[model samples]
Target: GLAERKKVTHVAMESTGVYWKPVYNLLEAEPIEVLVVNAQHIKAVPGRKTDVKDAEWIADLLRHGLLKGSYIPHRAQRELRELVRYRR
Candidate 1:
């Protein structure tokens, strides 16, 4: 993994509603911090429009500490949320 390979300690991701959950779950347990920014904010920035370029744009913004991360509850809290929703 890049985290182990490069001794990376931080990662950034743009939130995409519920879709980001599984990815978040996978990364949360790792020895790295996960940042989830609003997807709309990242998409609003002008840049060389392309699949790869978009990622680069985000990386640049994140690298500069220009992006803000959204709060993500711990796994236990998420599971509790799901349980309550299911019982509703």
Candidate 2:
């Protein structure tokens, strides 16, 4: 399935709560460029609150290079996250 998906050059996601780890991991494992953006940075205006449209908006911004990428640890650092979480 992963081979089917086109090679991703970058990833953009709205930074919500602490629920972004897995999402980050999935993308990071592919070794593609990743970006985590602030939700407020991409908040939609009135009458444009649909999920589909919101995703489209994010994609649009990413395409035009308007999205700001957040920090993602290197593979070693990411491994530490697993150890920290599992040990808890």
Candidate 3:
């Protein structure tokens, strides 16, 4: 994986609806720490609004440990919730 090749220790991404789930699930199995940050928090910071710029901004903040990750339940809990939802 690119992360292993680059020796990346942490990854941070904006939380946008249900889109971050699959990616998070994949990264959860990796050795690196994954942070799902609120988009609003990123927007709150004054910066240029471009995809490239936003990525760099997020990376910079993550590198400095300035970003806060949202609470994500464990895989078992998440799967149980999904099953319940499907049953409902």
Candidate 4:
């Protein structure tokens, strides 16, 4: 959209266990900020999930800084972590 034509300033993703790695990799550089919230933290009215409402819920939380962000390792640290973890 025209309104978002510029580079994205921040990104928000819901953490589903360890399933967020690929997403983090994709957005690590472009966006100046990245926020990964835990799925357990979001609460909605009792009903079936809808794409529109789900996006709204996540957006609302993100706007208010109410969503907790996941820890992202520094680049050097991340490389070291992967090396150690793989050696095990």
Candidate 5:
């Protein structure tokens, strides 16, 4: 619940293809801040490829406030961009 996360500050999410959009929109609706970072930026060194470990790494980076979020345009701007893209 959003209420339960009142004390929670920042939430970090890896920037996959386009899966992070809905999640970002939902969280943005709340007061909580959402950070979308490049997957390469948060990935561990070579030979450390595990889902659990990847999640842990992201969490650790987010907890320490080390990850920086990429720019996200306003919804209206996004819609306009989409319209232009489809028309092209």
Candidate 6:
């Protein structure tokens, strides 16, 4: 995996609706700290606009421990919520 290849210890990603869920799930089991940051928070900090530039900015922020991760429920809780929704 890229993370293993790079020996990354932490990862930060912007929360964009439900898009971050799958990626988060994939990373959850890895031996790494995964931070799902709010898009609003990222936008609140002024930075470059291009995707490449945005990635660089995010990396810099993460490296400096400036990113804040949003709360994510445990896998069991998430599954329960999904079951309840399906039942409804």
Q: Model 1: which ten-residue window has the lowest total lDDT? A: 45-54
Model 4, range 23-45, lDDT digits (tens) per residue? Answer: 77767756367887777777545
lDDT of 1 by residue, 48-84 (tens): 6786887788789888988889988888999999999
Q: Which candidate is the best by TM-score?
A: 3
Q: How well is each residue in 1-88 modelled by candidate 6, as lDDT tens digits?
A: 7778899899899999888999999999888999999988887656577878878888999999999899999999998998999999
User: Deviation in angstroms for 44 in model 5?
Assistant: 3.7
Candidate 3 vs candidate 6: which has greater TM-score? 3
Prediction 3 global C-alpha lDDT:
0.92
Cα lDDT tens digits, model 5, 1-88, are 6835577667888999999888887888766778999888877456667878887888888888899999999888988998999999
TM-scores for every candidate against the unseen true structure: 0.84, 0.74, 0.89, 0.71, 0.82, 0.87
TM-score of 3: 0.89
Query: What is candidate 1's local distance difference test score?
Result: 0.84
Q: How far is candidate 5 from the true structure (C-alpha RMSD, Å)?
A: 2.0
For model 1, which pairs clash?
none
Q: What is the C-alpha lDDT of each candidate?
A: 0.84, 0.80, 0.92, 0.74, 0.83, 0.89
Report the candidate with higher TM-score, 4 versus 5. Answer: 5
Which 10 successive residues of model 2 have the least lDDT summed?
Answer: 1-10
Q: What's every prediction's RMSD, in angstroms?
A: 1.8, 2.8, 1.4, 3.3, 2.0, 1.6
The residue ranges of model 6 lying beyond 4 angstroms of the native Cα positions read none
Give the better candidate number (4 or 6) by lDDT.
6
lDDT of 5: 0.83
Q: lDDT, candidate 2, residue 84?
A: 98
